[model samples]
Target: MHIIKYLRSLQIRPNFVKKISLIQARHLQTDVFETTKVKYKYPPVYDPYGPRPPPSEKVTQLADQIMALTAEERAQIGSALREVLKHPKLEKISTEGLDLSGPAAGDAAQAEEKKEEKTAFDVKLEKFDAAAKIKVIKEVRALTNLGLKEAKDLVEKAPAILKQGVTKEEAAVIIEKIKAAGGTAAME
Candidate 1:
């Protein structure tokens, strides 16, 4: 508003006051009488079919709420959860589908440290010659520790993960071995 007055004192030709008033009036009208806009039918939009439905407003709101939490808030929430779970009555609710006696509470830090030092891998067979199927199957068996029949079946299914959660070194060795046996393998 002060800028508008300054412009007026500078004798700017265009009337800023009128433009500002017009914009304000339009905004007010749209805000107050916008129910008609909402009531108007929208054209049908065809999206490619998928298994999962679109996220609801509540899910979006929940996601926003979670994302907006500070680290301190998250820590506080975690402590609150721990306190709640300590209750004997709440143990059943919290431990549902989880092995309550599996690990000690003292191992939580060790588990977190292990999570930070992630060690996992995947072996994907991209392509392989039909003639080398037998050799590829043998390598898959050795790498995956699968039965002969299962390994053969896995090798036949190209572009599939051969193994997962191995060390990266083991994954590389497996990929190299498969490639040497005339099969195209990828470490993922």
Candidate 2:
């Protein structure tokens, strides 16, 4: 028919085509247009400059200095640096003109001092012999149902009760108390 031919020949705008395709696709689950597959080719790379310098000037200077140094001199300098690193003294800088002392400074100093104080358990752990410490760790693990590492950590952290003088039975009681407190303990 002439009307049908005229309608087919008429150019439908892209927006109208898109709207109709979207509605048709949603209802029929069919895409209106077939996608075209495209393969891309990379553009050729260009090098503007020639090869760079062999070594940077700073690196070359460092290499030269190293080459110039005698082995003995290097060793002496290394030892001196190690000594300085091991024990560094803080030089007191006078802040008389500056008001640096405040609540934050006092709080920081207090925190540091508290960190330095040794706990009772820490002192006891320090006194434990290697064997006693091992036993304590094992016992703590058994009593608390904790892993080997955790038990060992506990024993190592509290060595006073893990000392050679302390009996296995006494250690068991301690482990029992820890278990009762909802913690793991080993007392074998």
Off by over 4 Å in 1: 1-118
| Each prediction's RMSD to truth | 24.3, 20.8
TM-score, cand. 1 vs. native? 0.37
lDDT of 2 by residue, 123-171 (tens): 1333345545555566556655789987677666653333233455665
Query: For residues 18-57, could you state the per-residue lDDT of candidate 1 as single tens digits?
Result: 6866676788675666555357675587556635778999
Q: What stretches of model 2 exceed 4 Å from their correct place?
A: 1-127, 159-172, 175-188
Top TM-score: which candidate number?
1
Count of backbone clashes for each model? 0, 16
Which of the numbered candidates is closest to the native, going by highest lDDT? Answer: 1
Would you give me the overall lDDT of model 1?
A: 0.80
Q: How big is the positional error of residue 67 in model 2, measured in Å on the Cα after superposition?
A: 99
Query: What TM-scores do the predictions have?
Result: 0.37, 0.20
